[model samples]
Target: MTADISTPSRALDTDSTLPADAAAPASVTFADLGLPATILRAVTDLGFTIPSAIQEKAIPALVSGRDITGVAQTGTGKTAAFGLPMLAALDPSLRRVQALVLTPTRELAMQVAEAIETFAAHVDGLQVVAVYGGSPYQPQQRALRAGAQVVVGTPGRVMDHLERGSLVLDDIRYLVLDEADEMLRMGFAEDVEKIFGQAPTKRQVALFSATMPPQIRRVAAQHLNDPVEIAVTRQSSTVTSVRQTYAVVPFRHKTGALARILATSDADAAIVFTRTRGAAEEVGSALVERGVSAATISGDVAQKDREKIVERLRSGALDVLVATDVAARGLDVDRIGLVVNFDLPGEPEAYVHRIGRTGRAGRTGEAMSFVTPQERGRLRSIERTIRATLEEVEIPSPADVSAHKVRSLLTQVAARQEAGRLSMYQGLVREYVTEHGIDPIELAAALAALAVGDDGPRAREEQERFEAEREQARAARRTADVRGPRREGDRPERSRGVRRDAAGTRYRLSVGHTHGAQPGGIVGALTNEAGLNGSDVGKIDIFPSFSLVDILAPLDADAMDRISRARVAGKPLRIKLDEGAPVSRARTARPTGDRPRGAHGPAGRHDERRTERREWAPRDGAERKPRHRTA
Candidate 1:
């Protein structure tokens, strides 16, 4: 049978107390969705007062056995949307794996399974098990044998279970693919197909995603049977309590800049995000060298070891965890006072996910992204996606750090004085003065100086030197010109998808509108793979069949080589220096022998050379050529 597919077109549910969309029934209690009384009581005991926008719409539809395609952010209570209904529909008498949930990451799988367990906490004879990689297989197999009603797992691990005949989908009445787009990005499309092929043909399919691309739509059309569409269009994904800010630090000065920021901030616990596992370790090591209490985790870390690190972070035993996006998954810490994006996430959704880690549970938090001058364009794209302006802040100088530390010391002294704890110290100072013939005030000043430490002042000279070199780099960037008077390898700027800047040469990317490319995807690929900051990227002008971007800093031999071979939007970009002239309709019918009209030759664009990675992260305000979509 052909599947039924629908696109979500609806208003957002903004009110926390009530449903904001007209379609979703207002004042929806969990009971409104025909949830079993036992399940309702369980969720209520967990302090869930009302159904969220997604939950309000999804629960009722899913409970009625209708396939559903839901579009909502990660934190909008989606787990409950699918979990409660799956529980309600399950027949407790039949204890086989009635429902199977697939996730992209082990962390998400564990989270979903745990939530289902909580919902079924009071339901006797309803067993739930979470199976994922990096854990013992025997225990998972044992749980399956114990007759679990629900099984949640990542795609790869699930496939392994299916191959070994330890797990079967023949009884799967409800099948859910959470974060479906993420799964696709992580290369689970084939595994999903295999799993679906093995499942009961008549089972209900519910695919949930934050964004739906053509690939996801195709999957839905192939599987879902007349799915109901539920979309919650929130203006932004960032939690309202997070304050976003950025600093335009050059690549070379990032370490010093980070030090200054950390010295002045009042964060008790923080997570420093980096682009790669190697970078995570490097950043963590650097932070420790700078005297910050921190640790690092990545995919290379053992599972047991990773869990211990996360536990340490939760209990405040570790002040920070420098991590890649994957490693930070499944981590829930309330004491995270700040989040530092040492490198921007290539995936747009990841930006929201990172900041969402903080400012949770009604607590205020801060997030800062370190931007290079050239990466400003990518930064702007991120801002547009979030629909909020990130306040641009200057890097705190050495003097600034010193002054802040001094204030902190004085504040401590004031607190002690208020508590009457200074009397003992006062007597000690008196004794020192009496014995050494020194002024008591002078002795007190000496003690205060010792407590404050001298690192801030001592580092002043290095800071000044660094600032001078950084300015010189910027100066070179501003004065260098690669534009006119083309060299042999340089093509026309129009075809190259690059713009010449005073600081660096521009190369046009081979992929663009004609190849289904978007600026967000392009920027994400560059920053994620090349380790380039958003500020390092200059203006991005996307055209119907091409794009032009300027790089503010001249990439060295190694950097240029990496970018030339980089792939974006599933296409290897054959980038070359811009030198060819624009193609016009006038050449459409002209003979091959006809002389070229423009100054440049009629030759084509290039001859070769070219993350949690973002497939598409959109930027605001780009001139796009419209195309029609046939339903």
Candidate 2:
């Protein structure tokens, strides 16, 4: 795949020039884009008075049955750009997957489907259903059987239904690939190609992506017929309204640092991006423990409930939303005054999307990224893409946090005064002063403490206690790791083969069982430092003082050095390529009988009996392993 990616237009500043085809009158509305009355009415009802540049140009092309390749960033109303035209062009009477929209994540698929439903709300007898991997099959299957006109789904799950004869596309009139580049990044290129093959040849294709990578351009050139290439990314890479800043936060103290940062920032609400679903939960819980009202949305969360969480975020009921990028798709909230990169995005384009969640309505929003000492390059890449240097900021001091808290308390007091209330509290304060026999000045100080939530102890003291304990724990683990391989309890289901993609390369990493390294930690490090998805990481074998991991390809010296600096289980990875054969033999396998359940003993004390590795030959033309059923 050579770099077939078409160059995007000039800078995206407000005054920047746009593509020749994208020119439109500032007064143009969605109704002026030749959409049918039903969709136009829906647009009006949805408060879409004007058309986005992409929507303006794309709706017309797609309505006329010409292919379109929309190149735009996230939060540019791309969903509406494709959905309006697809809805307007669909013949609702002939219902058998008339239009199929493919998104990268289940959350995005649900978002697109919901928008499609909203756009087609007035269209009579039209049915829409979103199908993805996480949810049960029965509901999606039922929707299809009930004559759904439009089906939106992720690629792998869509492929599943297609293979099972559940989602027939024979009558498919329109095929839309949303976030095509994201799908590729998630390793769904093959599945998307298969889907392209399955869809009807005589169909309109509308493809949109934030980037035009080589693979995407290749796919577009191969599948699209004289496509209208609309590029809307001719503006400043990062928004001018977003004051970008970063802090050098150590990974161990990250949670505490996050608490302090959030406390001191003037943000009304914020979104903290994490690397994985598990990490999202962890960070969210940590924030809650630190007295922040936080919630988490990830692939683990049900589609039905994500709306409520995001609504809370928008309503300012939730102060912080800890989320992974996949789960936070289409999460628009105007009140968000901050965006925190708890974990840097795995891709540069994702960085833009994360920050774009805020600074909406031409309002200034602050974005803060927590960069580890090892992740400077990731920071640099983001700066290169955003075309602006992020201001390096220092972590908030304890005094700063305390001052912010005092300010917040004073603001609350002022609001109460403005409300002209609190007589009940005043009466109580008088009663307390009389009952306790305290001086008026002392009584006033006590009341102030109560208002400021001074729980008769110092907040700094507690934070220091927590930090000291964590440091001690880290030290203890480092000391224990040097002794020998510690017996791993609560281990994952022992599988023989370390699974890797076909093109994956094997690497050996120091600090394995002895260092308390687990597959989860390795996955975390790779996602953070190597910019690789969990799926891109292959088989992992835990050995004494070392481990073997399978990755997509051999990393160059710089990447390998970055991995070496990355920590897993509080130990530096110190990675090196494993030129030796992949550890596929059965001797490397640990069977059930090797150790008693819940057993924990020193390395040399355990028995070394192991299961022989056996060749996994396909039986009677059966598949050795099937493609994963999620895109």
Candidate 3:
């Protein structure tokens, strides 16, 4: 199991200095890499004109069937660096798993699977399947049984299938350990080692990690053959063309701040990055409610729908796209003039990737991040990672939004006056002024106020509320500064005094008592998948063939999409808003003395008399619970 791979056969440091005459070619296309026409065509179709630093170096070695250890940060196109070459070398005609890629999280597993699927689109019979925890096993098992040529999954899930005899690595010719350091950090080292042992001894291996810790080095030396080592410099320099800045905004007001920021921004289009899919849905819906043209894309979005959404952004039909990191990976659009971090990313590397979405093709772009009072340390970390201090900027105020709108309106008015197309409008205005015996200038002013939507009392009230909140936030910071260094628990809770007592909307789920669906299971699914908090769930009534659940109102499309895809009792919960009248239980009614037909005696209440409690057994057959991180 061990090899003398401490010193690799070849070392390629992309950041190393080279003589002017010996430098890498200015541009190297996929075709120049000697890939098959099928892969080349697919890459070209995806609009990839040149390989990234990692891709330029690693693809050739990978294509040569050499094991590689790549040291690169996120957002360096590592997926393509490994995926393109892997696709080129895979045996499409084979009907078993020839390539096995292990990721640290389900989000990454799905992302890598989708990227590889895009690369293998033209390679006939090259089926790719992604298996991960927190999902049912039936579908993934069926995918494996149906002869998937490539398998991508989290280590624990993959190990589970291997133990169940559903996934055999006997034919695995290519083994990839992506984000190896993350895997080790997430406690997947043992599972990874078992998988490595089970795979074919004579196989090409690629181990990519942002940092080469001692543990990762040990794993690489023990498991990999004499491999080529590749290192890509951090992406701080990649985003030099991007003007990075941040705003200190409270979490509750982020949506309003984002709407105002977008309204005032001159960028043609923007992408807002959130830390989770649920945040994406919430932020996007809030933007739309604020009259901003916005859409959302997350892991829940279907591939075709995602493609259409991206196309809309490119075509300038959509101005704002709210997305999670994995969902927006490898997204390219020339018109993305701005990037907004709706929530600060957990890692600086992720911040780099999120901002890199813009400032492509030598074009200048702007990246703005929202920082809460507690997130100052994270902001500093990003600054250190980027090797630059981000400019602290103010969130656009309501006045700023009004001024921008007024400027736009005045510009239109001037254009119309210059074109001499406002004669009818002028006549109508004059007639109105004459009938009311009002000053013409005052009438014009009133019309302008109406045009900019600045005349209403509601608008004035909202503006005052916004200013008051901002002032309170400033006062809190000042008090914190004067008092100095309080314990975390000493900090006061931030609340808007909102109540959750209102009855939320009702939705029907396809799982019920007959399907062994319990109230606990339904609550878990809603909180875990749709990002609903326990308090957001209102009522649960389980019928024989279906269930009615009440969740907080204003469920956005993205949340609904996630809920629809969620599985309970090993079945898809085709959730939809309950539009029909309540289901009548008259036929199933029993005598007053008998037990009720539903899971409980009444709606919104669980059976308190039932004392039996069921616990989950570890599915991976390990002594500890399976570890996973999607958010």
Candidate 4:
């Protein structure tokens, strides 16, 4: 059957509108933002090409010495928005706490402090300290005395510092409230107010929030003076490449349900969001028990320890992260392929922020929330607020888990075979067969039985039970289908089709014969980096300069992000969709004279030179050559 496979649209339609002036790019560069040359150099070294919308709008206003209120969504480069300008304005020579940034929780405080340190790396004699509860105050007090010009901390610790005279904000020139709404939600409003009162009146203040509730607006009105109000609307809030869904699982079975879901779903790395610190710990431990490499992040973790966990996650050493709302703020891991809500967030806004972690930049991501039976109403409320309906998925069965395990075992066996180490095992088996005078088939069957473990019968029984359950689910789905299609009046409608399928869209990748790419190489990379399997991947057509591959739609944003960051053949794959016209137009625009010849190019010219080179090259290297050269 000829499928109607086309490239999917990349635009995200949102109700949020951008300011008319924002359409024009800001003329300012890192140097123009009053940042010292050292800091600007540092930013360049970190691979940032241009300031994001929030940074462009908030930076200059902040540098002009005005109290500012910035309303921007998560992942809009808010850290650099405040960090770069603040660090540039700092007088490193003055050791007495010149700047104080208050975050809602310890995780955010640590994140802010890390960003400050990163931006201030080239600046000599700059001291940045992060203070929060759950740790000894003596070390923090010592750091303050030893001279920290920039202080990033939670409100409670800042208050404690003020009371103990360990941190003197009387000399503070710049005060920033990062994620002010979160602080208020965490009941740190009174502490924040007290901290504001402690600071000098001449200080410049900056309040950045995702959403400005009435209370946040009132606080901004009271604290900021004729503040330059910069609101970055939801135009940027539409993360285009992310495909979001939710699963309705009871609260008691949430942990088991999450495990089952992960077992069946294709995800490279996943982040499980919980409501509390304790929940993060409990869930993380449970995932580890189930053989998943998982870790937890919360307020209780030390700064050094949190950094270690985050680093491991980025490096793929950890596949799952369980974190609370406060613990996960400012986390930007490109490899996160999925975001799962083990427990529904208390607030609707928190739900948005939780899922926002996965789909970032221009990559596709998947967000799944686990809703309890009682919490279905709350889930509906969240759906109404976001103006999006979530699709429900069934929990995976034991058979699914067994299939995954068996596939993994086979893969390991294949790898061992390729490594040419099976000779030892072959000899051992041959000796056993000859000594026992047993039939080769019987011997092989005995070996296979041993490999599958002594409890193989029990495993088969479990698989049978799981298959029975799957049959039941299929019957139920058929019943639903027979009931008739959902009508518009059905309040919230269900999402049709499989979650694994990318909805029948094609994407283009910058890797092909030119990059030593094989079908297996592409499959491995997609599976390892995006958590997709070989079955989900469609047709792969390799061209000289690039390749086009059919991906199941809608693509997962987190998975795409991981693919973007992944390296194949020691080169970064700059992949995107062809969308037909763009590729055709570019190809048409190219002059025939400029086009390089493939393996089947004209003879007697450099074609022979290319052919000779290909003949001398290794098989892998030859595969990287153009088709004309290969011929």
> Cα lDDT for residue 513, model 3?
64
Residues 498-539, candidate 4, lDDT per residue (tens digit)?
Answer: 222212355667665666655544544554455342334544
Error of 3 at 276 (Å): 8.2
Q: All candidates' lDDT scores?
A: 0.68, 0.68, 0.72, 0.64
Per-model TM-score versus the true fold: 0.52, 0.56, 0.63, 0.50
Model 4's alpha-carbon lDDT is 0.64
lDDT of 1 by residue, 1-631 (tens): 1111111211122323221221243465666678888887766544344566788899899989999999865545677789888998898788688999997765566557766776786677998888775456799999998899899987767877898899988899999999898677644676789999999899998899989999999999999999999897543457778899998777777877777778888877888887666678888899899898889987557545776777777777888789876556445667887998987765445677678667755689999999765565567668877778999777776767767887888878767777886778778877888899987677666666566564445666766876787687667545533332222233224443344555345656767666766555555445433445444554444444455555656656655555555555556655566654455434576686765444323333221111011122112334112122111
Candidate that beats the other on TM-score, 3 or 4, i.e. the better one: 3
Model 2: how far residue 334 lies from native, Å: 9.4
Candidate number achieving the greatest lDDT relative to the actual structure: 3
Model 4: worst 10 consecutive residues (lDDT sum): 2-11
Report the number of backbone clashes for model 2.
Answer: 11
lDDT of 3 by residue, 204-317 (tens): 999999899898899989988898999887555436788999998877788888988898988989999987677899999988988888999876676568878888888889
Using lDDT as the measure, name the better of candidate 1 and candidate 3. Answer: 3
Q: Scored by Cα lDDT, where does model 2 land?
A: 0.68
